[model samples]
Target: MRLEIRMSDLTVPEARDKRNSLASRTDVLDKVGVLATLPGDMHTTTEMVASFYGVDVELVRYHVKANREELDTDGYRVLTRSVFESEFGSLSNLDPRARTIALFPRRAVLRVGMLLRDSSVARRVRDYLLDSEQRIQSMNVEPLTGLEYALRLVDAEKRVLEAQARAEMGEKFKRAIEGGDGLTLREFHKKYFSAITETAFMEHLYSKGYLINQIGKGAVRTEGPKAGTRRDGTQHRHPTYKGKRFFYLHGGGIHGGKRREGTRVRPGHWELELRDQLAAEGLAANENTAGLFVIEGGNSKGLA
Candidate 1:
């Protein structure tokens, strides 16, 4: 006997509901906000939706274009510059006005999936969706064990402790930046380490260095540096509404974007040539601080 393969309404709305169930069960929906049932917007984009079903982006777009009115409810969006900045503000050295990007939210992707009749990907999407429904039906949520409850308690406590640690560390770092004489980091690095570049001087310090402090992929509310001159000789400025990235080690915010060459020196070499240079400039560091700062004109100072 042959079996007839039919499933319930495997539409985008159904698929989304299915995924939301999966997200709650698995709890990894932090990156994309699909499970978030507020008003309209969800982060499962057109490109992402296409990729999820293994279909060509163009094919998805074609289907959406042919069925615009039907899919107009809770569909696509042209992401504005401000929205894009809010999302990817931590990206380093990017021009905010470079270009506009398109996004397809939950309903839009689902509508396209519903309309796609020919692609194998669309068929797979249907199959998985049905499977997901089945999985949801068959799921057995047993009661949490004593150990599991304890583990959750422990995890919550750990998060609070980590937040406190972060706050304390931020204060220490602020003091370090504003600590010593009014010498800027650029002046300190140039005056001390005479390497081909300031970076090689720093990597040496990371090993023999002080308790190295590093900051990565975060926004600075300060002014972005001047980019270039326009054809009309007018200058363009990065908006204060946007944020720029910075990397820091020790007290200097000048570590990343500097490349190193072959055969960097070891600790023994740091005090000999590097420290000798510092002595001439009336500067000195304990063995902990070796050569950890770079010479870019930042407000941070007090490098050893």
Candidate 2:
């Protein structure tokens, strides 16, 4: 005997609500554990937040988006003041401290299931359902009968499944990185770091302890100036040790160059000792400390 699997038919009201919920749910889930509830409107919401704090809307959005994960987990209403304090370091910056005292309303309508299973089949189902609803809306037929709407919903689910399969296959690049096979610098860069700017790249390395301070002037003159320049008329530096060159760290923001303050300079000890140690281990071949970090420390070679 063969077992047949089929989805049960949905009523018109059920189908419509499901479709709307799919879109809403996806948006919320994308930011799950990051936002407590949905914003009324992405644009207007930013403006509202800005007005509340008497700051530029763009800045408010930037801060909000950056700390979305923290906000969601902590609960927006409960953590709003803390989030602002952590981001700006104090409420003293605001002219009227009382304005910053207000918290966001906690009654945000969010379905936890949507956010948790974003990469699972549930997301695909929502996408398809929403697409079907959109198609139905575009039909320009006034008052679609219940049966027609249901049929559209079914068709949408089919499309969503096809789209999901395509998306699943598209994640092969990540799999490649996680696999342990030898990859050339060019290949690895293409697969991972190509889209990241030099500064952002360096910041990431610095955070990981793979890179330290900006390359000194003496090193730059000897090693040949890098492609970019720092504000102090020095060429941006790459990771190096004991005159051996390693990986190149880009020194800009992910999207582009922006002033980044409070980045800790590389400690003198890291440059003197850590560089020599890695070199002694034969990890810094041809001054490729960055590559060694990826292969050995970063576990890049584990990708098969």
Candidate 3:
């Protein structure tokens, strides 16, 4: 007897339930290739769907073709020869004419299972599919309990704090580089030591017993807090030497140590000018040694 069926006779949910119930069974689902398609939108052939339902492929195809409106609503497409070859190229053992109307997606398989209500396997699959969907949904929403969520939140907060600290350190490094070894002289109110004048700063270093003129490159602190100006015109304390309280003075002055061109003999009396100022600051005669100094190669007497 031909299995007479009418898809319209079943309710929408009823038809879905019928299809899904069979889809959930691993045994029948595996036979149909639908079991292997978990977590992915997979496809199955009419032959496979028929095998899962324990029905003839022709009978399954006949009902699907007759009720195309309802069953082919989604993911159903008839592939052309080129499409079949390109997409299912690796699939072997297909019929000679299979490429004429090629692949069937998962929807087609589910639709077929719905239509073949007479098969006992189809009924079981429908039940299994419904159960599986519920189980999957139950597993989807956060698997964590209250304590687990709280612990995860705390870890996330710690990570955010660590990121903030790193960002602060990076900003400080940029500022230090901008400031002249943190001894960058600035023009503040001239009222009372409002800002350390270049001369006063150098004198202070000399007073602390450091040679003011022979200071070298290693005197500047690159990693610590360098002199930085804020957007509001406020300035922070300049970087200081790690051990001593001496100021790191940048090299270069207007007193005439600079050579214009061609003249090797001191063109300007800048060194004398510096020496005179250090003397005024009560510096010992031979003590201008903290800043950059030139070692006279010809004679030790030429050393300044």
Best by lDDT: 3
TM-score computed on alpha carbons, candidate 2: 0.26
Off by over 4 Å in 1: 1-45, 69-72, 80-100, 106-111, 118-121, 132-304
Q: Residue by residue across 188-235, what tens digits does model 3's lDDT show?
A: 111113344656654554455433233332234445455332221111
Q: In TM-score terms, which candidate is top?
A: 3
In order of lDDT, best first, we have 3, 1, 2
For each candidate, the alpha-carbon lDDT, in order, equals: 0.44, 0.38, 0.46
By summed lDDT, the worst window of 10 consecutive residues in model 1 runs over 237-246
**Could you estimate the TM-score for every candidate?**
0.29, 0.26, 0.33
| TM-score, cand. 3 vs. native | 0.33
Global lDDT of model 3: 0.46
Tens-place lDDT digits, model 2, residues 1-304: 1211111222122232343344343343333222211111111123333443344545544544554553344244433555645643342224343344323332111222222222333344344444566687788756879999999999999999998888875455434432332333343333334564545544555455444454543332333355343233232333322112233333334444554322222222223343454336433223333322223433444332
Worst 10 residues of 2 by lDDT: 2-11
After TM-score superposition, the amount by which residue 276's alpha carbon in candidate 2 deviates from its true location, in angstroms, is 35
Q: In model 1, what are the clashing residue pairs, if there are any?
A: 186-295, 210-288
* Two-way lDDT contest, 1 vs 3, winner: 3
